[model samples]
Target: MATFLFDKIIFGPVKSRRLGVSLGINLLPNDCKLCSFNCIYCECGWNPDQYDQKINFHPKAQVKESLFEKLSQMKANNEDLDVITFAGNGEPTLHPEFSEIIDYTIQVRNKVFPQARIAVLSNSSMIHKKSIFKALNKIDDNILKLDGGTEETIINLNQPVGKFNLDNMVKLLSKFDSNLIIQTLFIRGEYEGKIIDNTTNAELEAWISHLQKIKPKEVMIYTISRDTPSDNLEKISMNELEQIAKRVDAAGFKTQISS
Candidate 1:
C-alpha cells in the first residue's frame, strides 16, 4: 500500500472527479503529513512521529506569493481554472494562519481569476475553532467530512489524534446550514482485526439521520480511488455509491459521487 505526498505548496490544476480543473494549495509541511486524523485511506500516507519531527507549516506570505505567481501565469496563458482549492499533503485548516491565508487567497483569487471559486477540503476536526469555522464559511466551497454516523465508526475510520465528540461535531456542522457541503467517504474492510464499513444498512441509516440534522447544501459521496495507506481496504462500487446517493437524495440533500 504505497502512498505519496504533494511536494509543493502550490501544486496541480488537476482534473478532479468532483470539482473541475482545480489549482491546489498545500498549507502543511512539504516533507511529511501533519493532521489531526491519521486516516488509513489518506493518499499522503499516515502521520509521522510528531514527537521527534520538526513540524513547519508554509508561511502565509509565501503561499500568497506562490499562488499569485501561478494564477498570474495561468491567467496570462488563458488556462482554464475552475477553482482555487485548499487541499494538499494534509488538512489545510491545521495551519496556524489558516484564516489569514484564506483572506489572502480570496484577495488573490479575486484579483487574478474572479471566475474561479475558492474551496477547502477539510476533515471537519478543526471546525470547533471559531477562526477556522469563520474562515471556512468565507470560502466558496466549504466542504467538510462526515465519514461515519456513529462515534465508533468515526473513531475507527478517521483515527483522530486528539479528543473527538461525534455529537458535538454534528451540532457544529449544523451551524453552517445550507452553506456547507458534507463529504463522506464510504468504504468496507478490515483494519487491525476490526471490520470497517460505513455502507451497511444501519450505518447509512445513522449517517442519513445526521445529514437530516445538518441540512447541508450538498453531499459528496466517494470511495477510495487511489492507493491507500491500508492494504485491506475495499472501494465501494459506483452502483453502490449511487444507491447511497439515492438514500441521501431521498433525505432531501443534493448528492455528488466520485468513484
Candidate 2:
C-alpha cells in the first residue's frame, strides 16, 4: 500500500528516535520482499510468501547507482546526514552485492559528508558469513538485533527458518571485534490462537545471562515502535522496559530506553 515509499535506491532522511535523522538505503527489490526472519514486529511486513518475496528487484548495480545519485543531490543541497543506513523493506543482507555496496557507500559518503556515520540495522541472520562481517566491520554503529536470548525464545519471537540455530547465531555475533550494540524489543501478546509472551521472569533472566557472555558495548531495549505483522503482538510497558534497562546497565554496559 505504500507506493512512493522511496525514490531510487535511497529513501529517507527519516526521523529515527535512536539514530537521529537517518538516510535510508533499501537494497532489496521495491516490488517483492525477501528476508531471513519473519519477525512479529516487522514494519515492512513478512518476506516472500515462503520467506522469499520473489519480486523483480533491481540488480545490485542499479541499486548502487540509485544511492549515488540521491547522495550526490543531498551533498549539493548541503543536507545533513545523521547516519547513512542500509535498511529497506526486508533483510538488507539478502542483496547479492552486500559487501561491495557497503564499501562503495563508505567511499562516496566520505568524500561528501566525512562526518556522517554509517550504520547497518541487521537481523543478525547472515552474520556468520565472512563476507558479511567484512562489510559490517566498516560501520560506525554495528547495531545488531538479538530479540530473544534463548533459542526457544528466539525461534518464537523471530520465527526464523526451521533450521535457524540461535546458539550458532549468537556465537557468530559475539565474534565481532567492535563493541556490538544490541537492540531488543520486549512484548507479550497472542497470534492466531497462540499466546506469545516474553515478559516472564524466567525469560528475562535467560536473556540477561545470555547477554553477559556476549558482553556488548551497549544495549538498547524498548517496546514495539511500529505495527508488527502479527496481530497478537503487544508492546511492553515503559515501566517494564525501563526495569529491564536497569538490569542491563547494572551488568556494566550502557543501556538506553526509547520511551
Candidate 3:
C-alpha cells in the first residue's frame, strides 16, 4: 500500500468527510512524519527512523506568514472555508510553540474568516501537557483520537512511541467536560500477526464505557478510508460503522459517522 504526506506548510482546503471545506495547517516537518503515536492506519505511513534524520518543525513565524498569505488569498478569491484544521504529516501539537501557534491561528481566523471554525485533530498524546491542554480547550473543535478502549488494544493499534498510559489519557479526556469531540477509527485486521479488531461487542462495551466517562460533546466514528502503511488492515463498512455509532448514541452521546 502506498501512503502520502502533505509536502507544504499550508496544504489544502480539501473536501474532508468529517470537516467541510478545510484549510489545513502543517506545523510539522514538510519532509517526514513526526508523531507521538505510530498507528498502522496512518495515511502518512509509519513513523520513519529519526535516528539520523533531522526534524525541522515549522516555526511559529513561518506558520503565521504562510497561513496569513493563504487565508488572505482565499478571502480575496471569495473561497469557501468551513474550518481551519491543524492536521498534517503528524501530530500538530508536537510543535514546540503549539500553544502560541493556536493563539496565532485563532487571531488569523478571526481577522480573515471569522465564520470558519478552528480545529486540532490530535491523537490525545500531548493532552497531559498543561500548555497543550489549554490550547486544545481554546479551539473551536478540539477533536481528539480514541481509537480503542483497552490499553492492550491501544498499544497494539496506535503503537505509542514513548511513555503512554491509556487510563491517564482517558482521565485527561474526561477533563474536557464535554467540550471536546472524540474521534474513533474502527478497524479490524491482522497487524504483525496479531488479530486487531476494535469493533467487537466486548470492545464496544469497554469503549462506550470510556466515552461515558469522557463525556465528549460528540463521537465521530469512522474507519480507514485511505492507503495505509500496512496492507493487512480492513476498513469497517458503513453498516458496521453505523452499528458502532448506534452503540455510542445509545450510550447517551451524540454521534457522527463518516463512513
Candidate 4:
C-alpha cells in the first residue's frame, strides 16, 4: 500500500498529469479516507472497511470566503491559476452542498481569475443523483471515471458496496446529456486468487460497446502513474496505452493517452 499523497483540506496549485497547475478543492475532511468505492489502485490507499463519514463538514459560506481570500492573494501576487479542481482524498460529490460549493467556486473564479477553467474530478459514483449531475454540468471539465465494464471487475477493483451494479450505474450515467470526459484506468493483477485485467481485449470490447451506448464526448485512457493500494496491481505499459488510444481514435472518440 502507498502513503496518502495529500492531507490538507485545500492543496496544490501544482502540476497535474491531466489537469495541469490545478488548484484543488478538497470537499472531504482534511484527514481520513471518505469514499463509496475503495479502489485497489487508489493513490489515497484502500479503505477496505468502507467507512466513509464526514469528519468536518465546513460551512459553505466559510469555504467560499476562504477561497475568495486565497484567490485575492494569488491575484495580488500576479500568480496564474490554470484550473480549479474538485478532488479531495475522497468523493467530491459526497459533500452535502457540492452544487452550491461549485456555484461558489465559479463565482469566485470568475471574479478573480476569469481565464482559469473550473474542473471537477469525480468517481462517477453519484451521477444517478440529479443534483450531482447538475453540478458536474457547470464545470469546464467534468472528468468522470468508469474503470471497468463488467460488474465483477467493477466490484473487485472499485469495491463499491450496496446496489452499485454496473448495469444500473451505466443506465444512470446515460441521463447526463452534457459532454463527459470519461476516464478509465487500465491495469492487470491478481487479487485473492482472482485475475484482474482491465486491459484485456474482452474488457476493451465491452468498454467500447458501452462507450457507443453512453456516447461520451471524450475518453481518457490512462495507466497507474503512481503507487497503489494493492500489492498485486501492475501498471500498463506506454505502448499498450497508445494502442488503446489508437482504437479509441479510430472509433471517432477523442482520446488522450495519460499515465
Give each model a TM-score.
Answer: 0.98, 0.91, 0.98, 0.94
Cα lDDT tens digits, model 3, 195-245, are: 999988888898999998999999999989889999999989999888888
Model 3 Cα shift for residue 126 (angstroms): 0.4
Give stretches of model 2 more than 4 Å off: 1-8, 50-55
lDDT of 1: 0.92
The local distance difference test score of each candidate is 0.92, 0.77, 0.92, 0.81
* RMSD (Å) per prediction: 0.9, 2.4, 0.9, 1.7
Worst 10 residues of 1 by lDDT: 47-56
- Relative to the true structure, candidate 4 reaches a TM of 0.94
TM-score of 2: 0.91
Clashing pairs in 4: none
- Angstrom error of the Cα, residue 132, model 4: value is 1.0
Measured on C-alpha atoms, candidate 2 has an lDDT of: 0.77
In angstroms, what RMSD does candidate 2 have relative to the true structure? 2.4
lDDT per residue for candidate 2 within 111-199, as digits (tens), equals 87788889888888888788998888778888888887577777777888557876776678778843678888788877656566767
Q: Over the stretch 1-259, how does candidate 4's per-residue lDDT look in tens digits?
A: 6657456556768898877788887777665667878888888876536345435765677778768877888899998789998887878888899999998888888889999999888888888888888889888898888898788887887888456777777776677663688889999998878899888888888888778777788898888877787898888899999999888888789998887
Error of 3 at 151 (Å): 0.7
Candidate 3: global Cα-lDDT? 0.92
Candidate 4: 10-residue stretch with minimal lDDT: 46-55
